[model samples]
Target: MGYKNLKVSIIGIGRVGLPLALFLENLGCKVVGIDKDSEILRDVRKKKMSFDEPGCAALLKKTKMTISPSIQSGVRGSDYIIITVGTPLYNHIESDLSYIKSVCTDLCGSLKGGQTIILRSTVAPGTTSYLKNFVEDNTSLKIGKNFGLAFCPERLAENQAIEELGLLPQIIGTEDNFSKNMTNKLFNLFGVELLFTNYLSAELIKLFNNVHRFTDFAVANQFSVIAEKYNQNIYEIINMANKNYPRGHIPSPGLTAGTCLRKDFGLLNESSSAPDLFLSAWKINEHMPFHLVNSAKKYTKIRGKTIAVLGYGFKKNSDDIRDSLVPKLLRYIEREVPKKVLLCEPNIPKKNIEGFKNTDLNSCLKKADIIFIAINHDAFNKETILGKIKKNAWCVDLWNVLGQKQLVLRYN
Candidate 1:
């Protein structure tokens, strides 16, 4: 089908779905974004973006697609229903499928033949197969005969979704030929490579992509801890090791976390026989905040001092805070009995910040006795941050964004 003739409905128009909705709408597809959140719906109706995604804000203003809070009405006449709802981990590290189950239940009444259902959320293995069976069992439609279902994972990084949506190769996982052909034709419009696989492989592909990066980060974090024990500079070591050697490419350590990396480890190892690898990586990365606090305590006193956390977002250039390590870092700092804690997240809107006072960079720097560069955003560079802070203030920069050459240092 041609882009102009295709009609698509995207469910859960948050980080994942909203970009796809705008991208498809830009392609001349009749797109409808469905979200249960009334606030998100209101923002979309007014062409206001609730979060940050490069190049999406301009597209949002010109987007002519329909956005509504009602799932049934939004998905009624759509040729494709894409589910991008979040699947987070519970406190016990088990995969939570309540969002997926709820979406499927609400979609049962709207289930009809000749419609392609694409799951764009990151999920555990067998989730797509289970959802395929669930849809067939709950509705009168049979897969390949009247209905189509596929698992096409969203692999775009936040803040790069607008560009990557059309650039990255798409992996389509389906059980039958009907879904395979439908999704193939749909994603082919992007003019990128397509890899077709079964439902389980596609699910595993998404999980593995994140788990691999998470484990790599753990290696860097562990190395940083070891370097600190001997008072050696990790930045110097990494720079020497990787400067001219092609085989020596080590990632610098920081607060390694996000909604996907932190949770996907548990999702993959939840049922797999090899759980130790994931558990070890999880421990190493999770211990970073505590390690930073303990290390700072050894250098200078955190008790009754103002502590400033430079960035709250998980990664740089993104405003997504879901599963960010900044909260855990805050909790650890709070236990140190600091008199005040100042938060400065430039990417996140002031209204979205809760339970803490969001201050400007100058205010945070001036008031802070100790500063922790939790995230390495470009705005927190040496020129912007170094000249502003107190000359004698203790700085803990895991990201090494300030060009200090050492993890913890003071100008004096």
Candidate 2:
């Protein structure tokens, strides 16, 4: 089917689904976004976007797509259905397939004979096959004969969803050639590169990508610990190490916080049958949060002192705080210290965090006895709060936000 004739329905209008719907709609497809939350549906209908992604709101408004709070109403007459629901882990770190199963069961009840079902959620290597079996058994429909199934993993950054969606090469796979070609044709509408493989390989490719990133960041975090032991600067050491001709690709050290990075590593480790180095990478990255808290405490006397936090988001220029390391650090300090804590997040509301005093960038720098630079926001970096802090105040730079100074404890 052509892009203009494709009627697509996206389930779960969160970070991934909402942007994907907008991108598909921009490519001339008739798209409908489905979410259980009425507030999210209302915001989309009123042209209000929750995240700070580029080119999202304009596309949503320009396409004039339908956003419905009911999933059944959204997917009733759609030719193509894409499931982007979350796959969180349970208490034992096992992959929770409850959401994915629910979507599949619902779609089976409303199964169209020639419709295509695509899974955009991340899962284990054998998850796609399991889903296919579940659908075939529950719906009494023949797989690869009556309906098509495929798995197409999403690999976009948080703040750069729209730009990366059009730029990054898409990886897709299916159980049959018809499903493969159908999914590829749908994705090629965006005018980007495409890589077609088997379903299991596509699932493993997503996991491998995140595991590689976790390994690199774990190495950098370990180096930061070594630097603290020798009273040396990690940023300078990393810069010098990257000067080599062939092996000069040293990554910077910082708090590795995000939903995909942390959860994907845990999934890979849980699903692994043999021992591997990825497990070590997972442990190191998981401990980096507490390591940062301990390192900050060693440099500052936080007892009975006001602690000022510079940023609360996971990364720069984004408002997503999932798996953010700052909360762990704040909670640790609050348990150990006997003083008031002042959080200074410009993007997040002050009411979300209890006992947090809301202050502007200037006042936080002037009054804080110990300042922690958790995230490297653009506004916080340009103001140069290092020189403005009190003479006796201690500064903790987790992402190397401050330059080489006498009062700052540079973690990376």
Candidate 3:
């Protein structure tokens, strides 16, 4: 059957699920968006997105999608059920499948024959196979013969989900041709080509995709630390080296905190046969926050110091706080028991700093003795911050985002 004639139900409308539902709805497919969190569902029901994702809120207003809190009810009679739930880490390492298992429990009761279930969450390599086993064990229906199952792990960047969903090459892995054809038609409507593979291979693709990105960031961050030891600028060296060289361009060093990079690095170490390189990279990236804290100690005394963290979000131009490293810095600062901690994120409202004093730019500049640029938000760039900051205050630029100045310490 053609995809336009399909009805799709998306579970867990946090980041990926919300946009996926809207995109499918935009393609003239009847869509149902389900989540266990009623609060999130209420927000999405009113076209309110909690995070900053491009084109989500705008398209949400125009889409004809059913937003529900019950997975069993929402997924009924749908041709496809797409799972986009969280697979957060346990003990900061292993996959916590409680969320996915609960979702399976809710979905297995309402699942019908000839319907396809898509696993879009990033999981350990054997998770899709686990899902296949879980469904068959719980329900009377067989997986491939009576029903269909496929794994199409999400690969979109946080802010660019809408565009990347339509542009990036999709990987759909299944055990049989029935599941493959059904999954292919689902993505074909989005104008994205599907690269077919087995279940474990598709899972590894996402696992390695993110883990390697973490390793790449780790390499640059290690170099940045080395440069700082010599009291030199790593950004200048990185820029001159990559001016026109196209063989292998390295990413800039910053707090490598996001939902995927660190979480998937842990997953990769657990899943990979040879995990020496992955473990080493993980150690470098994991120690970055402490490294910044130690560097901050050099310029100013942490005890009884007023430190201002510029942005709370991990990525630039995006307000997603999932696995953000600002809190890690804050945790370290809290250990020192500083006089005051000021948070200034213009993107986030003054009232929403979460019990901390939400001060304006001018206030943060005036009160803070040391300022740390945790995220290179355009709101707090050198263009906007240079004249505002007090000359006596020390600024730590983790991303080399500041101009040359005595007080402005461009942290490697």
Candidate 4:
């Protein structure tokens, strides 16, 4: 089929699926986004993006892609069906496959011969094999002969999804040669390199990639705690160590909880044996907010002080707050019984920061007796924001965005 005639139905037009839909639509594919969220469908109909993703807003404004709430309608005549629904972790640190299971069951009615079903969500190992059997059991279709089934994991970063979708190599994992070739043809339209593997390996690849990053971030967070105990600057020490050495490129410390990093480690450790390294990393990263609050308490009293929390987003410049550590930080701050709390997150929409006393950067900085640069957004420029802060305000900057000598700084 020609690229223009390639009908692609994307289930769950969320952060992952929306970007992919926009990119494929822009790539001359007939794209249709399937989302059960009425709010999301309404926003898509008005050409309004619900989240921050560079390069997708403009494409959404002029795109001809269809957005639908009905799974049957979305999958009726599409050549490719991509599942991008969320697979969140439960409180017990296990992968919750409820969303995935629901989608797969819904898809059985619409699944037909000659159509390729691709699971693009991050799932546990053996999920693809399970899905293949589920579909075969529900319908009379044979996997390799009648329809194609593949596990094509989405490896895009949140803010860079648009750019990375077309640039990053697509990984396709299939059980049969027929499914492999069909998936290859579909993703090859992106003009990126394609790596083909099996279902278990591909699933492990996604989890391993995220777990590696989670552990790497934990190392920095652990060092930050160690440096604070010694009354030394972790950022400065890292810079000194990595200045001329190729082997010593250590990342600086910050709150390191995001949707993928926070949950994927648990997903990997779900079935693994005890003495889990990922769990150790999780402990170190999860304790960062408490560490920040405790570290600040030593120098200044948080009780009855106006405190400003700058930037609530998990990542630096993105507005995605799922699994962000900011909420945990806010909870810690609340326990301290501050006189007033002001939240300032430039990237997040004001509507999203509800139930909190939200304010602009200037006002937040001017009124606060204590400040925490909770997220190191690029907009929190040290040169500019430093001028507006109260001279004697006790600032806790774990990211060290403000070139302060230490984590806790009290400007005179």
Candidate 5:
């Protein structure tokens, strides 16, 4: 039951699982990362990363942990079994619990009596409780008696996963004290404060965090539209309003999206009785992709012009594309039938995105007739972009965050 000499198996070795596995290994635990994607396992074993994140590349290089695709070989006889699979949004918008339930069902087959299984994936409000029942029924073993089950929400942002894992307070809850204590001890090894609560409360905490962030962005996005009507930029206005002003903190307006931000909204809506605000925020964020496309067409016909989407990843320094507005913007622009579309995301590898000409910053700057700054990566400066872009070529700064945070509202 002690931290050292513990065996931890993390199911689903994507962004969340990989870092968690590495952290556990750093804590002197023997870690095994199991995923069905052989490509991910190959990249991980070879120290070749599929995407870029803060502190991920260096950590992957030095990791001596076991990574495999076979669940029996990876998870069997483990002291702790952790599920970090996704609850992705499907049909454009709805909680698809396929991955979570599938992972749980598979995990039940590999469960060792007395081993602890932690739910670290974001889920609907009652999912943690439901998992306890599902595992008991499937395994024919009592959850609290035969094994420990805890819902420990994974709260780290993609780019800041490593730092935040140690810095941010972790939320964990279980039916019995044994699982609760085990989760706390495990997270404590990561150098974080444990915020213990009930199972459903912990699950809701994760969903609520995602809901609030997107809703706040929706408010900022609405302000952006209103500012445009008055020949003003909302980013500047928000900055000016928040200048040393108490209770004036507001997130900047931009492409409001991400896998968690948009997907969790569906889970929130399904779980909550009053989902009006959540639904509204989703609608507003959903409209933003088409909004950028329509705004860009106001300049010239795109039928034969080459368009360069400067950044397509969900956010700056992130390679996750789940529910990102950049792809939606691309889909909408495809209807406009541009001569060609070039995706210019230096952080994202070319293999992740298909069909589009994924090129470097230099090539995109030279070839584009219309340039849309979809994401505000640190590398792109407004002056530097202006220096690179062809004069008289249209620039549609959707995030309005090229050289600076404010986008000039005057679009002509």
Candidate 6:
């Protein structure tokens, strides 16, 4: 069937699911967006989007797709069911499949014989097979012969989700030709390239992609540390290194935030039985927050000091704090530093942090003895507040907002 004629239903209308539904609808497909939360459905109906993804709100308004709170109602009678639910980690960095299982079970009960199920959530290498087994065991329905299954992991940036969805090439995987064709047919409508492979290859592709990023960020962080000891410009050094022929891809230094980098590395390490070199890179990136805290303490006394955190979200131009590095820094400050910590996250709600005063950016900057730029928000580039900061105060540039100042101690 052509993409325009395929009726698609998206489950878990959170970050990735919401945009996917809207993107499919924009392609002239009949799309139904579903989420467990009634409030999220209500928000979508009212054209209220939660994230900073580009073109998402406008797409939601333009598509006018059917939004439903019931998961079963969304999946029934749909040609394709795309799952974009969260796969968060629990204690010891173990993968939690509770949400995935719940959604699969609900779908299996009502799924028709010819429908296809696509898992867009990132999982371990064997997760697709495991889910297939679970679905067959519970519902007594054959997988492949009865219903199709595939994995098409998301590869979009946090802030550029909608644009990336329609622009970036997608990686799809399935066991049979029919399933692969169905997956490719739907994705092709978005005008993005589709690379087809087996299930395991696609799963490893997602993991390896994140691992490469983890290694890059670790190298950048290590270079920054070395440059700080030698009193050199790390950014300049990185630029110079990139000038070499055929051996240049210097990554920028900053706290690697977002849900994928930190958690995917943990998944890779846990899945590996042998000694993996990539795990060390993952450890380096994971320990970055503590490293910044120690560096902050070495330059200035954090005890009894008023520290102002400039940004709380993981990265700039986005307001998602799922696995943000700022909270880790805050916890370390509270444990070691005997001072009051004032947070200045303009995008996130005040209730996210406990016992900390969420003040305006200007107020926090003026009252703070130490300013930590957790995320480089655009509003901070204004010259008035930047000039007003006390010269004696230490500035921890975690995101490299300030280039090179006498009082600035750049962690990235």
Off by over 4 Å in 5: 272-275, 299-303, 403-412
lDDT tens readout by residue for model 3, 165-243: 8999999889998898788888888888889999999999998899878889999989888988888778887877788
Better of 1 and 2 by lDDT: 1
Candidates by lDDT, descending order: 4, 1, 3, 5, 2, 6
lDDT of 4 by residue, 1-412 (tens): 7756799999999999999999988888899999999999999999999999999899999988888999988898999999999989999879898998898889898888899999999988888898988888999999999999999999999889988998998888998988998899888889899999999999999989888988988999999899888988788899998899989968889999888988888778888778778889999999999999999999999999999999888889988888889889989999999999999988976744857756889999899999999998998978757878998999999988888758888977
Q: Give the Å shift of residue 302 in candidate 6.
A: 1.5
Q: Which tens-of-lDDT digit does each residue in 1-412 have in candidate 1?
A: 6666689999999999999999988887889999999999999999999998889999999998888787778889788999999999888778998999999888888887899999999998888987888888899999988889999999999988989989999999998999988888788777789999999999999999999999999999999999999999999999998999999989999898998999998888787666598899999999999998988888899999999998988899778888889999999999989999999999987844769877888998888999999999987998888878976899999988988787778765
lDDT scores of the candidates, listed in order: 0.89, 0.79, 0.84, 0.90, 0.80, 0.79
Model 2 spans > 4 angstroms off:
273-276, 349-351, 354-358, 405-407, 410-412
Candidate 4 regions with alpha-carbon error over 4 angstroms: none
Model number with the top TM-score = 4
RMSD of each: 1.4, 2.4, 2.3, 1.2, 2.4, 2.7
TM-score, structure 1 vs. true: 0.97
What's the residue-level lDDT of 309 in candidate 6? 80
| Clashing residue pair totals per candidate (backbone < 3 A) | 0, 0, 0, 0, 1, 0
Model 2 Cα lDDT, one tens digit per residue, 2-25: 557799999998999999999888
TM-score (all chains, Cα) for each model: 0.97, 0.94, 0.94, 0.98, 0.92, 0.92
Model 3 gets an lDDT of 0.84
Q: Whole-model lDDT for model 4 versus the true structure?
A: 0.90
At residue 221, give the lDDT of candidate 6.
Answer: 81
lDDT per residue as tens, model 6, 1-412: 6548789999888988898888888788888999888888888888988666778878876777888877788777889999988887777757887888898778867888888889999987788988888888887667667778899999887778777887888899899876877777788787888888888899889988987888888888877777877878777787688886478887877787678887887666676676666767766676777777787877778889888887777878567878888888888878875567888878765554546666888887777888877777876653635676765777877555665532255222
